[model samples]
Target: MGIEIIHRPLRTKNALWLPDRNLIVVKERMRSVHTRCSIAHELGHVHYGHVDDRPKHEVQADRFAAENLIDFAEIRDHLGWIGHPQLLAAELGVTHRLLRTYINVHRLAS
Candidate 1:
């Protein structure tokens, strides 16, 4: 995928990396935010040297993705003002699961 993001309709449901092109292709039906997340996650794999045969590489990539997309200080400020998890998730274009996970993982809620 020469472009920033590739949409492959005939491919699998999840995003895949074309190592030959050094690109990440995701499903055609995926949301723009999800596509962005896929790109960031794949970039994390490259940035963190996750190419090695490690058992928990996927987990690390996921963590990196969340960290890259989310800002703990911003979340804390929004939570302090809004007091609604769903609204914060909606603003961030992330799932409620990830919003809650970020709060818990970063101790944002105290």
Candidate 2:
């Protein structure tokens, strides 16, 4: 009732909160990994009761998403044995690009 994942050509992957209906729409076409990330972001907004009036909310959502989705412990275990980014990305259920970004953002790789 709170959030619904929809597939559409959204200018940006975002959610629309309908106060009247108490519904949230999340883009479904978002990258495999980003789907979870976006879900977490929207949940953060709802959990914190963010007004979504400022662009900063997106950044905050992203931070919440990274914290929720990227399993640092699992990532470390996999990366320790697998040096290939693509392989690790596949195992982590994310794209290579997203994996690289996650790695860089978390400083998981040197």
Candidate 3:
């Protein structure tokens, strides 16, 4: 799949996936972690064959990003000593919100 990645200034959305053109557009000013997550999420959309812009598709994409980006075993092994969410996020190289979402969606006991 010849997927092209383009970075530009997006107004409302962090990223968008054009399935027809196999294109992923990301916001240029986003932080590195955010850009990575957004691209992963868009790739998730592509992998899962999500063409409709629905909430379920977004959730699935989120799940895909979380599962692929963070290692569950690593988090489980390190989470006990990690007191702050920010610290855990930093350790996992993900945003605090993405970490929280992964915890919630996976129902991992914290």
Candidate 4:
């Protein structure tokens, strides 16, 4: 909960969590939604004690971000009128990746 967040120029990454420093560094050029989602994803790594970039850890982080960022009620409202993933993501104020991760995780859980 004491993790620090800073915006810095990252050449090739959206965001990353520094375990040693309890800090989350986000790329300065990301859009608002992406910046927020990236921070949430990095916080997931902090919450889950992730120190490496394993696929499972990545998914876990993504799921954490999606669940927190996209409300299920909002997704449901969009689902009735929206059929495209991109549209749904846009309407929900999330990236397409987050929308897909939400679906995939819920699919697995159900």
Q: Which runs in model 1 stand beyond 4 Å of their true positions?
A: 1-4, 10-12, 52-55, 80-84
1-110 in candidate 2: lDDT tens per residue?
A: 44554555557645564444545666656665766655666776766677664677765655665566668888877866447987887777755655665676777776
RMSD of each: 3.5, 3.8, 1.6, 2.2
In terms of lDDT, model 2 sits at 0.64
lDDT of 4 by residue, 1-110 (tens): 88989999999889999999989999997899899889989888988999998999999999999998988889777675345888788788888898889988777223
TM-score for each predicted model, relative to the true structure: 0.70, 0.60, 0.89, 0.91
User: What Cα-based lDDT does every candidate model obtain?
Assistant: 0.66, 0.64, 0.86, 0.87
Query: Residues 71-105, candidate 1, lDDT per residue (tens digit)?
Result: 86777567763468778877887656556656766
Top TM-score hit? 4
Clashes of each: 0, 1, 0, 0
lDDT of 4: 0.87
User: Considering summed lDDT, which 10 consecutive residues are worst modelled in model 3?
Assistant: 76-85
Q: Please identify model 2 stretches exceeding 4 Å from their true place.
A: 1-14, 28-31, 80-89, 94-110
Predicted candidate 3 versus true structure: per-residue lDDT over 1-110, tens digit per residue: 67999999999999999988889999998989999899988988998999866999998888888889989888888877456778888888887767877888877744
Candidates ranked by lDDT: 4, 3, 1, 2
How much RMSD separates candidate 1 from the native structure?
3.5
